[model samples]
Target chain A: MHIPDGYLDLSIAAVMWVLTALVIGLSLKKVAESKNLNVPLLGVISAAIFAAQMLNWPIPGGTSAHFVGGALAGILLGPYAGSIAMASVVAIQAFLYGDGGLIALGANLWNMAVVNVFVGWYIYRLLERYSKFGAAFVAGWLGITTAAIFVGIEAGLSASFRYPAFVAISAMGVWHGVLGLIEGFITAGIVSYIHSSRPDLEETSNAVISKVPVAFIGVMILLSPVFAYLAEIVGYSEPLENVAEEIGLAEKQSYTGIFPDYTIPGVNEYIGTLISGAVGVVIFLSLAFMRQHASAD
Target chain B: MHLLIEKTVKSATSYFQDFFIHEYSRKTYLHDVHPSIKLLGTLAFIILSISTFQVKKILLILASVYVLALNTGLDVGVLAKRSSLFAIFSFLIVLPVSVFERDVVYLITFPLRVFASISSLQLFILTTRFSEILYGLKKLRIPGMMIDIIWLTYRYTISMFRDLLSILVAREARRLKKTSHIETLKGGSKSLGLFLLRSFEKAEEIELAMNARGRKISYRGKYRAGFFYILYISGVATWWMML
Candidate 1:
């Protein structure tokens, strides 16, 4: 769902960047407090979103399936952390999986992270005011659908600009519109199950926020290339083979050719592997530092 | 050879989109020109390029901008690669505009044109520095309030995220952090809720900071760029002149 760099027009992407920044600008203050609001719990939630996104499942009719990036993260982390968490996921996808380009990072960040967190959060909340489980169902559905439409329209826009002028953006929206229906339903089911079972999560989140630590910063400085090897292992591992089976999503990924066997080597691969390590380290250490400081102050 | 160059330029725009291309050896001259010049120049070209794309004019303006860009000391190879990424992203964003499905030329041109105009703006930012552009913006009266907010937000965001990471690290260390995978999940949900509450409070604090500093526009009326301002006004005039 991350629409990496070099995929769209520079001018259009610029507008999206400004818009994304505005949202983030507005979100910056709120996001900061979130650190103190949730605690170490944000880390675990980020990790879960990361892990879930990794396993691209299949839709029942046979296309590929990826996690509902914004919806799932938003439900747990709210919008701010959820947006960043999803951005982190896209970054890894670009570096480790070579899924999207770098320049397109802003666009991808906007479409996948921004849309998922903000758009999904609102839509989900709107549905949930009526029933407890309804929030999850709505969030998951809207999150994925919104992302899909964003991607499809972006494609049509690019095509019209590039070549035959008449080739409209909505031309492709039909495909995504259909996909959104299925995505919404599946996501709703998953969210309903998870949120319903874990009621404690709804309360007592802020107790976890705290200040950052020095040792963790040291870790970020020392970090480098281990994730590529890890990705390779993950790509070949059969343990996940059974995951889809359990969820009955074995059909989703198989149809779309989502799981491509990637060999991570060369210049870009080296950099990505190193950066992913650094990013992970940075986040972990940052968490450590915040926790210590939050308690002391 | 001119068409060859145009074709090459078109190809390069797409090239910028593949992987995140970085600034190559072209960094030697780094802003041998002023930041304000580069930013304004980039913005101007972005306008022309975007207009050309939307007008569906013979790609003449787009090609001319590309040709002009090629003459600069900046690394063409790297830029070519970088531009394409934004192009594709903008491409996708504009793609959905077709959702109106009516095939209105404005839907086709205006929105796409606006998007392209800004992608060029992004290119300017990446190529330039925040300080220089802020100087340009300040000189141009783009609104100090927005700019200051951008600066403060960055400081606070870094500080806050840094703080959050430390907290999570502590939880990891407690008791080998073996709170069952499920317990870990509980910890996460709690943290997110807390994070939201704090984020709201932080927003209020920032607002107070702005207010204490006196939240008035430094240039509310006519911009204060002296003679340089006249040239900028004319440049914008030239842009509208095309329309």
Candidate 2:
């Protein structure tokens, strides 16, 4: 799960760094808002997680898998604190151990910390209402799966990387899905034990989201196709296409009609692109708006 | 299974201990270099190595890394052995590109890049003290709280590692039967849970002790790079630009 340097294009890595900085900044604020938060406790728990990762449990075939502990962190601390702890652990691994590359830290943190912590936290929060064991199990499973998906996308998006997008996705997905089940059972057992012994430590708070931000995200999604077309216009081909050409593979044309490069086929290229973008924006915004209204109700 | 656990514990403990000993025992020019300079040099080396795909440039960088490592009084054999797993993993990553794409340039460049980057990082870690690095980071103005967490984590990792070793030994000594895989997993989980519980308790004690002293964990050091470090850095930057 550790992406080494040169695994991603510099541009993509820069973008990930910017995104990571924003999330970490937000997490810092969130953690600070908690009056009872013990900063040193966060450090100690992170060290514990790092040490615990060294312990490998035997699987059926004689091979063993170490615990990731992201989900466990989220269960004990809320998402923001969990993200901070996981990010610290990851940073230590990179800077001290050289287990991961410095340049790729942002992308690695995005995959392993932000995605894993948030997905695990939210899913556990959502499902723990019904069954604690099931929540932990599914949160751990989905957390790793989602992280794997991002990893595949990041790797496959690099022209320097050899694997095709689908190949990378499928391979990462299948392998990590199995790994995730192991992770799931371990997380469930840990959480179950903690629930029995120290229920007081479990996080009870949920992250609050203002409607304005949700609406803003919806608008951004609606305009995404336009951004995509603009990106294409700037000679930025899809990562998959870039890699294909790099490897001497012939570019295959699937569809070049109204949605050629995600533009409206019948109109002028720019106009067609705008129309397609508009359509995508409307569809996404509508879905988001509906979800927001339903949840509010 | 017991042997595996014992080996894991031993290796992990030794790895940290080795790092600690090497930082204190080694005395060389590189060791005296400011932590910021070494850190910047490491980052520059990695960035420059990965910035190009030219075989000649990559090889030159690799040779330069080796020369630097030797100058730093590191044993090349030991460094290579320590980094062997990473080298093998790097080879595996680009193996598919070599076979499927048959891109000779990529095939040659990728592995070299990985090796050069890893070696550059190794050079930095081998010579610099962890405390010095943290102090440099503090001077760089990374968030204070984050640095606090990292410093605490580093301190506790050694202590908790000792705890982990003892736990593993205790488990191994108590076990008598040939347990099934499921049983082993259960036992592993229980031990891990107990280890974590102990760490939490120890953390509470540490927090109380710090509070009692009315002091926060502060990384205070007066280490600064000299003119020579700047000159060397400029030379590297110039070489990178020429590449």
Candidate 3:
């Protein structure tokens, strides 16, 4: 779920914008490395994901979802470019289709695209090294969850920073955490099928682990504050549209209390653990996975 | 010319913000507002519309629509017709919700939430121009690289879609006659898979061309900034928040 502009404070919104920009900048440098790098093809994937999003599959909770596009891009194009590609899709959706709001670009990009890019690719690379099937399955699985966690973080961050609202980070985290697993299965199945048909392509792929790591780390550092600023903006207040009355859009308000409504179970704790586990796995696997791949080769 | 402009503006006003139909291009009162503002407006409206089951707020939202119809010069008849597409889809999914729940309040609230989202979205699409909206974002200093990928991807999408269509056609022709529905289904899927593989190769070539043209991710603007001034006239925007 891409939140709109003015959902968050300007300060937060500004921070997100900075992070998204940094990711894009770094992607370009990486793209320049190989002349044979496929632009239109990745572009096609972006477009298809954009179009496909219009067709959502039904999930439980009376909700429907389409492709996330981030993991798909990561698996196909590698991580850095993958992040940029997914962000571009969000941009087009914002500007052209208005699916995602212009202001929430930072949050959406950071959550849906950036986090997925680094986490998905790194995880996929590691998993495949040990067992191709395992890697593909995990890549697809985490790909879906990465966005869920990111969205949860975003919703959590937004609630904490901007407004004390109906849904907290924990609520969103649990909600999307369950929601994303469905996507993970679909993503894994698709990746496994594709990789099986073209396993050689993965090994020969231009994206070696070492080169990508440096780029992502550098980019992440520079963009973190920028993303923080953008999130602050969207999470905070923004000018209202030409409505006769002001709508209930307060970017960030001081939290009044723990939260009420939604008598869901240890909902918050479960979400917290889920996010923590995902991060732990991503960090642990990226290092251990890369080493395993290197040794296997 | 004046009559046509009036009619077009009217058509625009009536449509629930049909994103990126920049037929009017340069100027109209609505043209100058920041995209972020319109986005926030819609978000606020949707949230507000959903949070209440009161007839009063629904009427307010409806009134907002009427005002939109007046300001944008869209015909009430045409706008209502377009509005129903979303209605049809919403009703498709929601019919069951209302069917099973039966409780008036429960049925009503969720449907209204859907309606509010659909209508507010239409309002956004009708009012904003994609390129100008993008210009506004660029001015806001969103990354140059993301913008570049979007621009290139957009330019290439139509062609790629067309290419897939042709390949599908040729593949079908080579197979002589139509097969069982299931057979065609399997064949069709495999062909599309290959198309994806080829497209990956296609991206590499485009990247090469991009590099050859001296395009870097952070390349200084090759496009004129004159247009940004048109959208960024709210010179005090940055400080507007600070104050």
Q: Name the top DockQ candidate.
A: 2
Give the interface-residue alpha carbon RMSD of model 1. 23.1
RMSD of 2: 15.2
Could you give candidate 2's per-residue lDDT for residues B114-199 as a string of tens digits? 77888778777777777778877777777778778877887788778779768877987988988876676666666776777777
In the range A169-281, model 2's lDDT, one tens digit per residue, is: 78888899998987887778777777777676664334453445334433432343343234334433234334434543322344233245765333467875675566545
Q: How do the predictions measure up, each by TM-score?
A: 0.41, 0.80, 0.56
lDDT string, candidate 3, A79-149, tens digits: 76677678777777665554544445677777777776666676777677687556655665566665655
Task: Evaluate all candidate structures by whole-model CA lDDT and list the values in order.
Answer: 0.44, 0.69, 0.51
Q: Provide the lDDT at A290 for model 3.
A: 25
lDDT of candidate 1 over B46-149, digit per residue (tens): 43443333343213334433333343334455445544554455545555554545455534454444334433444454444444445555666543433443
Can you write out model 3's per-residue Cα lDDT over B1-243, one digit (the tens) per residue?
A: 122223323432433244325333433333444665555555555544443444444445545554554444445565455445544554454455456657555445444544554566556656555554555456667555455667676666555655655655567567765464335324544544465666666766776787788655432222322232222222112111111
Q: Give model 1's TM-score for chain A to 2 decimal places.
A: 0.58
Docking class of 2: incorrect
**Residue A99 local lDDT, model 3:** 52
Cα RMSD for candidate 3?
17.5
lDDT of candidate 3 at residue A204, scale 0 to 100: 33
